[model samples]
Each structure stands twice: as C-alpha cells, then as structure tokens.
Target chain A: MDIDTLDLIDQYLRGNLSDTEKEAFEKRIAIEEDLQEEVLIHQQLLAIHEQEKISLTNTSYQQELVQMNEILNEEDNAKLSQKIRAIGKNQQPHTTVRFKRKKTVNWFYSAAASIVVLISLFFIFNTPKALPDYYQNYVNWEELPSFTVKGDPEELFEKGEVFFKNKEYKNAVATLSIIEPEDKWYPFALLYLGASYDQLNENEAAIATFQKLASLTTSEEYSKGYWYQLLLYLKTNQKEKALEMKTKILENPNHYKYKEATELDF
Target chain B: MENTERYIQALIQGEDQIIQEIYKKIYPKVLAFILYNKGNEDDALDVFHDALMYIIITQKEKRSVILSFEAYLFVICKNIWKKNLKNKVIQTDVLTLEEKETNLSAFILEQQCFEFYIAKFSLLSENCKDILSSYFNGLSYEEITLANAYATVNTVRQRVFKCRSKLIELIKNDKEFQKIIKWGA
Candidate 1:
C-alpha cells in the first residue's frame, strides 16, 4: 500500500528485489488482490510481446529485404561515385521516344503578326495571302494512295477464314476487323465478323452487323452468308425470320448460294 | 492489385516491372524478422530461393491462386530457417509464440501451410529438432540410437519429452502460430 511497498514490488517483478525485501513483499502480496492484479497485468503485457517473438511470415525474407536494401544503397553510392568522376566529362545526348508537345502560343502571336503584315501588303500591292493546306486537305485523301485500301484485307481475310475453320470465333473477329472497306475482301470480312460474333454468342450485335452486309445486296459474300443469317435466327428462336430467309434463298433457284442455304435447313 | 496475385500473374506473363516492385516492397520486413531470429544472410538467400521455387513449382504443378505472395513467402522463409536450425547442430528452445488473426487469403494460407514442418524443425533446439526430424522420418528411438551414440533409450525418451514440451510452449507463445492454426496447416 505504501510507496516503499510499490517500489519493492516493482523491483521484485524485475527480479532485482533484494532477498530481505523479497521476503517482506511475499508476506504482504499473499493477501493483496490489487498488487496481484497489477503484477499479473504487468507480466501479461510484457509476455505478450515475448509471445509474439515467433515469426508471422518468412523471417529470412524480411532479412533479405534489409540486406537487399543495403546492397542497393551500396550500388547507388557506387553510381553516385561514378557520376562524381564524370563531373566535367563529355557526354552523348540521349533521345528517348517521349511525347514532345508543340508550343501553342506561336499560333496566336504569329497569326497577329501575319494579319498586320497582310493589311500592309494589301494596301501596298493589293494581293491576298493563301491559307496553308492542313485545313484544306483535312478530309481529302485522293492524292494519298497509301491511306487508301492497299488490298491487305484479302490476305487478312484468308487468315480469318482459317480461324473460322478452326472455330476460333474471337480470333476470326479480330483478324477480320482490320480489313479496309475498299478492299475486295471487305464484304467477306463483314460476313465473317458477323459469324464470329454469332459464335461468340453475341446475337443482337451479329444480327445488326449481318443486316449491314445484307444491305450491300450486290456482294456475293452477302449471298453466301444468308444461310448463317438464317441459322442465327433459328438459334435465337426467331422461326418466322429464319423461314423468311430460307424462302427467299430457295425462291432464287439460280442463286450461287442457294445450295448452302437449303442445306442449313433454316 | 493484391500483391500476391499481381506477383504471380506478372511472373506468368513475364512482367519484370511487377516482379521488381514486389521484390523491393516486401524484402525489408522479411529481412528484419529473420535477422532477429539468429539468421544470417546465407540463411536469407536459401529461404528466398526455396520460397520462390516453391511458389513457382506449386503454380506450375497445380493452379495455385496465391492472394498474398509476400505473406506466403514470409511464412516459408521463417519455416525454412526454423527447420534448418533444428536439423543442424544448433540447439534452440522454442517456448512461446503470439500471432495476429488477419484473414489472409486461402492461397497464402495454403502456400504457407504446405509442408511447413521443415521450417518448424529448423528453429527447434538441436536435440529436440534431431529427435523430431528423425521421428518424422519414421525412425524409432532404437533406430536412432543404433545410428547415433546415446547412453540408453531413456535419454531419448527424456529428450523427446522435453523437446515436445518445448515445441508446444514455443507454439503456444507464438502469435504467428495463433494466426496460422486458425487457418490450419
């Protein structure tokens, strides 16, 4: 209860109490509830950490992490030393593929300067300045044949055909989507894209795409895909639509795609 | 991204960036824990090599879905050091352990628990670890005595008893053990 007793108890818990003091403390602590509770809580709190001394995870990895840091620090220090050595040495310029943005302020200042000069020129010589070709050629590509369809679509479409044959729907879709619209194989790309979508279980998207191909009625590719279009209808349980496609295909007896159309059975 | 999941996916996809990121982030805590446990840099090297190898092996052999690669690896490294300590001549006594109950992902727990005794034995005292390791290897005391020089069978008996008690004490005091047992190795 007294300060000396408290000090004795603290010393005892630390295993530093004198033998005589320990004896007196034991006699008092025998019936002292508060002192016992305090002792217990103190020991518990102390032991709690000791208990946690065991590993939560790989102890070595943590050690390695530390060692790794030391190694990295050493390496960084070495690099810094190298940089110091090169204090005034010659260096080669490095050009990385970074986005180099153009300054926009020149447009306003240059335009104001040009307008003033143009007013002077008009007063002096009665001539007009011609605008640059950037805006004039914005949409026009007739002179640029490279931008036009270069017939890669036919070759790519053949690859898509291979994918379709293997039933790789997504690959076929990807292979077909890159085709240029003006390529001879463009019609086939659209048709196969529709079939690929259908295989991927994208019914509505496939149907809408298929309808676009069907609207280009002049293409033989559209005629060939009529069966799949009908098959799509049947798959979606659109019986009326499937039958209508089947009837149209059957009615045109001389049509090159009629055989494949009838064979699908709608 | 969950570091473990990110780590594995990155490794599988050959993404060096993720690998470097994870390697940098978690290496410290692991190093500190191991160094405090009487582990040297060599032990660290072995622990990391073995842990990474195990992760890759498990991933390839079975579709391992590790959510926390760091946690999983930490457990492995700790276990390996413990096992090595026990198997080697060094006799260490484990008395108590404390653990926090963090609900780590299944993949991490499973990876940690998979054949963890290697690490456990390493941390045990030289005598207890040898006895336990021998026992685990299916060797009887007779066989052990035949292999090694013990005065009598009673010595082995006392050793095993003391060792088991010590192991129990170590585990009981270990907080990591507390967290891990709930997940159950």
Candidate 2:
C-alpha cells in the first residue's frame, strides 16, 4: 500500500479522520480489497502490540504466585511439625504411668514379669512378621526425576517434587495442590500427592487421590495409581482390599509395578 | 451476553474469587479433554492461561462482546492445545460437533498474527519501540510528548506514526509473516 493509504489506515485506527473523510475511506475500503487487507493487518498488529504490554504486566503476577506458594508451603510445614511434636509430647505421660506401675510391683514377681515383658517387647518391636513389618520392608520412597517444562507452572512442580524427595510430606502436599488439575504434570502430582498424604497418615485423602488417578483410563499414570492404592490398603491394614489389588496386578503382569506387587506378602 | 460480559469484566479486573470460581466450574472439562488427547495437566494449565490472556486482551481492545464467555474461552483453549500438540496424533473425539461448529479460525488467526507481530517488534530500535508502545498503550499525544521530552505533541504523533509504519514494514518483509498471511487466507 502507498504511504497516504497507510497514513489513512493509522488515522482511522486512532479515530483521527473527519466524518466526511471517514465516510470516503470506508467506501474505498469496501471497494478496494488490497486496502481492506492492509487495514485489517494494521488493526491486528495494533491489537497485538497492546497485548504485549498486558502480558508484560503479568510477569509480576506470576512472580507473586510463586512467592505465595513458597510462603504457604513453609507455613504448612511449620504447623505440621508442631503438631507432630505435640503428639510425641502427649505420648510421654502414658509411658511415665507404665514406668510408675512397674516400680510399685513386688520385687521378685516384678523381676520375673520384667524378663517376660522384655522378651515380648523385643519380639513385638524388632521381629514382627505382620502387615506393618511388610510395609516397612517394602515401602521404598524413591525420588521421581524432576521433569521440567518451560513455564511458571514448572517451577511449582519442581518445588513440589523437591518437597516430596526431602520427605517433607506436608510441604509437598501444599505445593502440589496449587498446580492446576489440567497440568500435564498433574497425574504425577496426584501420584506424589497421594504418597504425601499417605506419609502424613492421612489415609482417606491418599486413598481418594489414588482412586481418582486410577479412574483416569487415558492417563499413563493409571496403573501406577492402582498399584499405589493396593499398597495403601495394605498400609492401612485393609487385607481384603489389598488381596483384590494383588489379583489386579497379577492379572496385568505387564504393569509397571507388577514385579513389586508380586513380592508383596499380603 | 450478560454472563459473558460479567466474566470478561471479572477477568479484566483480576477478581481472584471469580477467577477461582471460573477454574472450579470450567477447568475440569478442559483438563479431561487435554489428558485424553495426550496432553498433561501442565499443557492444560498453559493452554487455559494463554486462552484467558487472549480473551482479556481481545475484550479490552474491542470493548465489546460477541460470543458467549464459555464458548469463546473453550474455543481458544482448544485451538491453543491443538497448536501445542501439532506434532502429536490427536484423537478425533477430542472436541464435540457443537464445539467444532464455532468459527474459531478467525480468532486463531488473530492470535497467530499477534504472536508474529510480537516477535518482529523486538527487532525495532529502542526509540521506535518506546514510541509505538506508548501509543498503543493509549497515552495521549501530550502525555507521550511530556514523558519522552519530545518538542511538541505533533512531533510525538509523527514519531508514533513513523514507528508504527516501520513496524508494519518490518512485518511485511518477514518471511514468516507472508506464510502466516497465506495460511490465514
């Protein structure tokens, strides 16, 4: 297009043209296809330029979101640690009462009783061949390789993974929960989310998340989710359900967790 | 129309509560669609954010609403996700017939053209960039002159026009721009 026509397009865009000139320009645009094309491109370019500015403003918003996530995770971690310490403190009085009862018993009988209790406690704490023992033997928490994609969301994923790897279950849960459900990392996030909940002893939440993950037929993470659910049931002393999951794993021997599932005692 | 307008207004204002409500209401379907189509939650989130940004920009620039908010947002998200999954084989059932019925090609073209312009805009001189940026940001001629310390309002106007024209010239000369225009046609 010529300079005058370009100028006219710019003026029209800025609403700088007079009424008569605007009328004439509109008529020319209706008749002249090239002029119309030029006008459209100009408008699109202007719109894009404006969009660039709006996007610039979003940089700070993205930063704030990252900062907020970190702060929230820290707060949750602190609260969880405090609760765990309080629970430990509460258990101390029960142990003291048991110690006092042992002191008040007759000397000869207490000696005999102590010997039996020591053997029983040793067997109970050190050599249990039960579900909890199997869980302790089989549960190996490995760090998932950090899969970084190009975006702000990836930062959250990485942070959540770090918390998971560090065994900061509460922090991991807080960080991963902020990730949008539609994110590609969401299935992995859900997997870790359920694992974190399990570690924190939030059995119901863990089971719920694992169930949700298992329900997604399209997810590559589905089989892994089912396997985790099976382990979770075992962890929670649900032997019947764990056996059902064992059957599922045995049925699909080619599943990712098939080998591990085969070795599980229950 | 009223619902769309309210949504658009909520977006422009960056109302966190409404935005959260939007996510709660709409994101699950988008997430399911992405996951089924070989996309992950990450791709879905990125597509949704980009789509929302496009809507905000379009609404602000046009000062008008045409399509329903849900339809417009879904179409934008679908197009962006398709673009992201260009190399992957997509399922035909990803979008329903009703969604496919929306004439989203125009908006898609506009987005492409905008992206192209942004890429080319970075190549302009700093002075030209500032002038054009200020102009597009709706700065008054007098305000632009005051900000940039140009001699007169007329000078600012001329410089803004010159910078915009230069941008157009650069875009016209670009091979990618030619391809985009042809593809858009």
How many clashes in each candidate?
42, 7
Candidate number with greatest lDDT: 2
Clash pairs detected, candidate 2:
A182-B41, A183-B40, A183-B41, A183-B42, A184-B40, A184-B41, A184-B42
lDDT of 1 by residue, B1-185 (tens): 36667676555454546545544445434444444455644444445544554454346434644456777778766765655555455534422211100111222343443333334545687877778656435466687777778888767756755665565455456555454443321
Worst 10 residues of 2 chain B by lDDT: B97-106
- In terms of lDDT, the poorest run of 10 residues in model 1 chain A is A139-148
Q: What is the TM-score of chain A in candidate 1?
A: 0.37
TM-score per candidate, chains pooled: 0.24, 0.35
lDDT of 1 by residue, A61-133 (tens): 3443344334323553334323322321211112111111222222323322332211111111234322222
TM-score of chain B of 1: 0.46
Query: What is the C-alpha lDDT profile of model 2 across B10-122, one tens digit per residue?
Result: 87676656666666556645654564456655556556665765565456545643567777677668767765565245444455422321212234344645556776888
| DockQ result, candidate 2 | 0.05
Q: Which 10 consecutive residues of model 2 chain A have the lowest summed lDDT?
A: A93-102
Residues A66-111 of candidate 2 have per-residue lDDT tens digits of 4433432355333432332333232221110000101211232333
